[model samples]
Target: MIVYATHAGGRYLQLKDSLKEQPEGKRGVYVNLTNRCNCSCTFCLRHMKDMAEESSLWLREEPSVELVKDQLESLPWYYVSEIVFCGFGEPTMRLGDLVELLKYVKDIHPEVKTRLNTNGLSDLEYGRNTAVDFAGGILDTVSISLNASNAERYLALTRAKYGLKSYEAMLTFAEECKKYIANVVLTVVEKVENQEEIDRCKKICEARGLRLRVRTYEDK
Candidate 1:
């Protein structure tokens, strides 16, 4: 799906169906830009869940920027509180397209919030500091995955293609985001890491002057 809404129990639904399920109130809408990722996290839902073809986020092929803009243009703006760039894969994998879409959202609905859920490795992916790409008020928040407390543990869990270096790069991206993004958040899955590791992660974020969120296993 190019655009969709997330429901309880980790369900992904079309906007129309989401409205039917919850007829009132605004909700965050998500865009699926691509299914390609740099990491194959051991706990990634794409590897654990089996989704039906009609509702699947696995794109048969990547959509053109114009096509995604069309979908965004037609969204039920009144019911949307936020626009999130997220999918089964890393949104930054399609960094340029993601940025264009973000700007499109801000242009059309400056009141609505915008966020990006990322692994925060675009620095390594693009061989440069990529957080600056979100400058000029295009993005409101960046939620980066802080999978583990240390480089070795992080690489072990994410199995990122960049290996041990991936952890540091992700952190650096998160820190850099603070300059451009209003909210810079780092996240760790609740059960994926124990209390001890999570505490360590908290300290890591604290030391860097970043925020941390412990997401439930089922959170998309």
Candidate 2:
């Protein structure tokens, strides 16, 4: 089920057969951009295995913008419901490439929804407000990782490069993202933290007209 795409006179193909199995209207394709990230969260599987090239996201190396464009171009048009920028790595690390790919996808399939599954450390990693860059992109949702409530607990969980600063930075980014993105969400892993943690996250998200999501810790 691999589909070939052409870009800059070069013919390239992207993997898609496995993704089509998702129920129609619930077809959410997860694209693994890279096996690189800034945070090495305890819950993250980056170090547990050869994750960059796995069954769910098959790739020897991160796909290029042209490669990603080719993959999206090969879709069955209506088989896909939502296209998520997610995988074993942080999609934002390749921000420019991702945005360009999203723009290309939206131009062709304007009805399909686009999303980013990120660790919310793009600002710290790039030393700029990354959310500001999503203004007109095809991105419909930004699902940020809100692993824990306080800084100490967060550091222990995420082992983020920036230490305690990562938590606050993510919150700030969520706030700024609400300005342009229609659906901005702060997601927390259950049990690692408690109701108090979820409550704090809700307060932060609510203050900025955003939503909070509590996802079951799947990697555990």
Candidate 3:
């Protein structure tokens, strides 16, 4: 599905189904642009979960910008507190489409917040300072996966296509995001790392002037 809401079982329900299930509440509406990613992270839910055909995030084809916009426009905006660019794949894989959609969201519903859940490798992926693209009030937050404390450990966890360079590039992207996005967060998943590692990751984020968020591993 192109658009879905996070459900209790770590399963995602299509927007229409989501509305039917829980019609009222402040929730994030996630946009699935494509099933393409530049990294194969060891703990990513895409590899761990086995979803049925209807709820599967593995898209048969990437949706066009207009198609994604249509899905967003159809949603119950009153119930949505935030619109996130995230799914089975890294949203930055389609950076142009992602930004355009963010613009579209603000154009129609200026009050609804917008965010991106990314691996923080867009600079390496696009060979440019992609943070500049997020300038203006289009994006409110950028949550980047900073899975490890150092480069070697990070490379091992993410197995990013860019190799060892991926770690540094990700950190650099997070740093740059601070200048553009309002809330720049670097995240590490719990259960994947020990206390010492989490502390060390916190130091890394602090040194970079960013916040660290410990995401719970949702194994459902």
Candidate 4:
């Protein structure tokens, strides 16, 4: 499915079915853009989750921008607090489409917040500074995966296509994102790293004037 809602147990509900099962109140709606990524992170959910056929995030085919827009247009806007670009793979892999979709969301529902969950390697993938594309208040928040405090540990975890340079590039992207996006955050999964590692990561984020989020590993 192109659009789905995530629940407490890593459960995913298709947009159409979400109306029935979705809890009353605002929740995040995730948009699945593609199943391609530039990194093979050791702790990626794609390697762990056993998704069902119907509710799977693995898209049979990448949906066009128009298709994604239509899907968004059909969503229950009142129930949505945030529209997130995330899925089994990195959302920025389809950077152009993602920006367009973000624009579409702002055009129709300016009150709704929009965010991107990315590995922050878009610059390396596109061979240019991609953070500028997020200007114009189209995106409200950008959550980047800052998996490790150092380059060596980062390369070991992410196995990014950009080699050892990936970690620095990601930090550069985060620094650039601060200029465009209003809320810039870096994240690391819990349990994977010990207290010292987490503390180091916090320091890294603090040094960059960014917030650090410790995401819990969801096994469901």
Q: What is the C-alpha lDDT profile of model 3 across 35-79, one tens digit per residue?
A: 789999878766666542444788888999999988888887888
Worst 10-residue lDDT window for candidate 4 reads 46-55
- Please tell me which model should have the higher lDDT, number 1 or number 4: 1
Clashing pairs in 2: none
Which ten contiguous residues of candidate 2 have the minimum total lDDT? Answer: 1-10
What does candidate 2's lDDT look like per residue over 153-176, in tens digits?
A: 889989999988998998899888
Clashes of 3: 0
TM-score of 3: 0.96
44 Cα displacement, candidate 4 (Å): 1.3
Q: Write the per-residue lDDT of candidate 1 for residues 30-49, one digit (tens) a residue.
A: 99988889999888876666
Stretches of candidate 2 above 4 Å error?
1-26, 47-59
lDDT of 2 at 124: 96
Better of 2 and 3 by TM-score: 3
TM-scores, each model vs. reference = 0.96, 0.83, 0.96, 0.95
Candidate 1: what lDDT?
0.91
TM-score leaderboard ranking: 1, 3, 4, 2
Per-residue error (Å), model 3, residue 11 = 1.8
